[model samples]
Target: MKTYVCPACGLVYDEAAGLPEHGIPAGTPWADVPESWRCPECNIGKTDFVPMEL
Candidate 1:
């Protein structure tokens, strides 16, 4: 699983535990982000997050 980081706020979106209630659910494909989710902390769109390697 990849880790996503919020470019605006530096929040780390973890695939392991999921994105909390504001995140995409487990097994959610990237294509589904637009309709399925939003950032928990800032309510920003999922597209704002970049995949974080570390």
Candidate 2:
């Protein structure tokens, strides 16, 4: 599994459990993350996520 890091707050997105059940609005794009996934802490778009070594 790949772990995603939030560039805004340095929060790591867990691939084991996946995105939260309900934090980011429903239908939020997670597939093409770096282009659409939003930061749960800051609500910033995917552009804020920086892939880190997991």
TM-score for every candidate vs. truth?
Answer: 0.62, 0.58
Question: Can you write out model 2's per-residue Cα lDDT over 1-54, one digit (the tens) per residue?
Answer: 556688778877655556656454333444534455567678877766666784
Per-candidate clashes come to 0, 0
TM-score of 2: 0.58
Per-residue error for 23 in candidate 2, Å, reads: 6.0
Candidate 1: which pairs clash? none
Q: Per-model C-alpha lDDT, please? A: 0.68, 0.61
Clash count (model 1, backbone only): 0
lDDT of 1 by residue, 1-54 (tens): 667888877877666656447546775545555654666667777777888877
Which runs of model 2 end up more than 4 angstroms from their true locations?
23-36
